[model samples]
Target chain A: MSKPAIAIDMGGTRIKIGIVKDNVILVSASIDADSGNGLRNRLPDIEKIVKDLMNGQKLTPEDIAGLGIASPGIIDTNEKKILSIDKKFGDAPEIDMEEWCQQAFGLSFCIENDARAALLGEWKYGKAKNYDNAVLMTLGTGVGSAAVMEGHLLRGKHFTAGILGGHFIINYKGETCNCGNKGCVETEASTWKLPSIAKEYSSFSDTKIAHVSPIDYELIFKLAGEGDFAAMEIRDQSLQAWAACAINLIHAYDPEILVLTGGIMASSSYIIPYIRQQVENHAWTPWGKVKIEEAEFPASAALYGMAYLVNSVG
Target chain B: MSKPAIAIDMGGTRIKIGIVKDNVILVSASIDADSGNGLRNRLPDIEKIVKDLMNGQKLTPEDIAGLGIASPGIIDTNEKKILSIDKKFGDAPEIDMEEWCQQAFGLSFCIENDARAALLGEWKYGKAKNYDNAVLMTLGTGVGSAAVMEGHLLRGKHFTAGILGGHFIINYKGETCNCGNKGCVETEASTWKLPSIAKEYSSFSDTKIAHVSPIDYELIFKLAGEGDFAAMEIRDQSLQAWAACAINLIHAYDPEILVLTGGIMASSSYIIPYIRQQVENHAWTPWGKVKIEEAEFPASAALYGMAYLVNSVG
Candidate 1:
């Protein structure tokens, strides 16, 4: 039997940690990242969670093969350190993650960008297992993406190639993005930007959505289902933005399959068919239609991917 | 000394044939592609041009190592055949290019997309020679692009990945492209679309561009220099479109250098500075700025690339 590995997925708002073996999570736990407190201050919580999970599983440090971490932002996998944390954990890049793992767990550790880890998880244990060329679009606080081309993960000179699909300019003359680009898909339609985008709609004052605070895709979808014009307009525009993003990924990476993930996919019944129609009508794929599917592992994709990475490196 | 190779660049309107050795062209010839006449009918002319170029160089079939052909379409290089012609050459996909070369010149043959060939040419013998990760954007009748990543030419599953950079949608709610996408960079500002785009400009009737027939970039730039308001508006729009394309390429390919080519670059004094500014201000390159430079070979990049391809394969 293969030994179990400890996996950690560090997101902007939460940290998910698990003990995984043979693609199965034995025990998992989630804690608020409390990122405003910085990652260094949260390191002790992560350690305690990992230890609790191992103890619950009746396993010790020697019983585990290694530790794997997936975090947002540019990661230097070779050094097992975060290179730049956009806004999530400001002090993450300065934290010596590999040294922390060695001293706390007494095991080897590997770290990769969260999006790339999600792609690896999908490739290894999900819908993309059958595909040699595939792309993943994760719609959450921001739009994150990763690609596998001809069976090799596309890591460019700076390890930023496939990870920036969210940043592709879908609207050349539109709003400016925090990434400094104008009219990125993330800027036009993402969870973090959804509230402001909703407020700016021309029909906002006359519709039910105006009364809703903490505007998100869930509320928009619910309101649109009730025939709210402003909500419907915002929903349709968001779908178009995502569909445009899908076509852009198809053109940029030439993938055989596009796997959609993240919190927004809860409405896949409406989102999937709409995006499918748009891509089929707009993408210039000469070979055949690229398969569009919802991602299988939603919450634990990075954890599963971390397990794969740790095992492969070990 | 290396044996000479016959190189052919098949464009929509013309065919350029040359005898090349050691990255240098010995002799060359050109003929109207007369694509409306069909590619099958022009195969004989292509053969004759190759023969004449070989003769002018005092070389025979035995002096050549092989033949390489570059065409503007999706190409199956393994089969040495064009896969899709996209209106440029209606009958090209059905023609047996390998059989023609074998019977007419007694040489082994290879074919690649024109844009990919140009990228290879630039990588082998131009400004990108020193960089392993580079992208080439050729701004002409249409925007054509190709990429090299980690020292390998990126040919995705369907051989369309790197070649479709021009087709990336920069405007989600913009015009529909002939390729089925809406608001592609090619649709927004390529040479073929310039007239229609200029005609729709708000200031068209009030400026000199309205009186110009067969509107091309040269006329627009000349009039813009003379302070034609419509011409200046159109020029700035076109520049923004091209600049957006540069940023899109940077986000997609993650290259160290961006090599610009094609006929529209004749106004590089205006274009280079504008695009460089946009890229520097907007591109999210955490490592460093991606260098933007003009292609070294303009008219004969594909021919030089063909020579390199033939020599490498031989």
Candidate 2:
């Protein structure tokens, strides 16, 4: 007899909105996002989307118990504020999420970093069920990650401990990231860096992917499967970075299960086995092997977790 | 009044024994450690030494509530046993420390890794007195470290999270460590690795200390202070490695204070300032500056922590 909650996963290209109850999504929909204009300028658009979602569902502000929003950035959920900005967020921190939720839906609201909320979702209902210690890494444009250790999200002395796993320096002098670090794993393998990394392959001069405007991991895997030498080389290199990042995560977080989410995992067939081999060979876990798996419910996951979060808080 | 605890810090070179009551060391003493042979062969010697210390004070086993030991290696404190042998402990896990205490003093025992015990001691009574989150690192023969994040010790999913900060790879292809990792901070800055690292320094052929028996951070710092070109180069490089590791630790464990302890910090006069500078300059903490300090008691810190372990567990 607890009240239902509205879960929102706000992303760059699209925002996923869902009404969840008892860990199930009752109604869900995706709306186009006006992200290129920057998160700072998209306030009215985002407000409209949330209001429309609630109106379309025929739910009044009093009907829902609370609202949960997952956004891309450094979020100190305690403050309910977006802390940092990156490629995905052009206008953030300025967007008063709490006020918007109060004015539009007349509900109490909670917000957390997208990766962290996804981890919460997985821990409550998805691949991480029954796991007290785990990490979920979303390998998309940038390597997004969060960790749960000893039955709690690993928010550290300043709530930044577990979320910065992607900024881990895998190569000391490899590549530059806008985070002011050099040779971070994300700077070498993530979708944001994939095009430049692909260009370094010997076959980049002749591959079919060269024709694509925004080349990515998907195209690399597909082209490699078609026997493109350069594509295979870069693909293997990217796999190494991801696998190394996984090993680093295993070392740092000591989580039992590392769940891979995000768009790049759509090519799970190629990435999974390759990364698994590297982990077995390189990771320094003396106790036993860490379980590596893929996420199942993904974009709707934070919504599902929202259902349980409100109850737990109460 | 709280019951008094007997704390012992066991090292390859020395043993420090202290009687602690409510976080204050009432009395303490030290004796040469048995390191010419394996540590397993020296337990009886260790026990006899502790007995002598107590006898000098005219105290009996019945007066002590429990014994706490800080040894150098992996520890299974819950079971009151050492788990493995590192450089100092050739055969430690084979020894039954808890049984030894029971037979000799008719008392229970608690044991922990030296690095972890030091952090615990600091958290409870030393520099990190009021801080609930902290990471303490000892830059001795190899970098030894432990972390407390958000008021909890990060034992991780594998019981290796905070204790293995030295093994964190700063450069995946940088250098090799005995733990099977490459470019770890320890492999670059620790005393045990300094000889080989110094050899590659340009001044190695001409430095005054190169003619000495063992080339270590001690000689490097000494010579660097005296204007040896090669020694200064090696010293600065190693400092940079350690500084990077500190920033990495800040991001990984998210501790409010980072404590530098152990042998290399014998010249903390130089290492402390540089680390604080680098952290302030490079570390991505928007909250504020991460405080850096030297271990207050240094050599006797783990012994102080041993008392804490005994009291908390026994």
Best by TM-score: 1
Clashes of 1: 0
Q: Which stretches of candidate 2 lie over 4 Å from their true place?
A: A199-211, A226-229, B22-36, B201-210
lDDT of 1 by residue, B156-191 (tens): 999888998889999999999868789999898988
Across B1-314, the per-residue lDDT of candidate 2 in tens digits comes to 35677888887678778877756777777767765577767677767767777777777877776888887766766666676546576677777877888888888888888888899888887898889889998898778789988787667655677877777777766767777766677777788787788777665677786798788788888888999888888888788778777877787787889988998887899999999997887676767889999988786778667787777776
- Categorize the docking of model 1: high
- TM-scores, each model vs. reference: 0.98, 0.92
Alpha carbon lDDT of each predicted model: 0.88, 0.78
Q: What is the TM-score of chain A in candidate 1?
A: 0.97
RMSD of each: 1.4, 2.6
The CA lDDT at A94 in model 2 is 75
lDDT by residue for model 2 over A1-314, one digit each (tens)?
Answer: 76777887888678887778867776777767676777656556656766776788887767777888888877777878887757566667777878877776677878877888888889988899899889888888788888998888777766687887778777654666867766677887898888888777676668787788789788888888999888888888788788877877777788889898888998998787877776777667766778888887766777776666755663
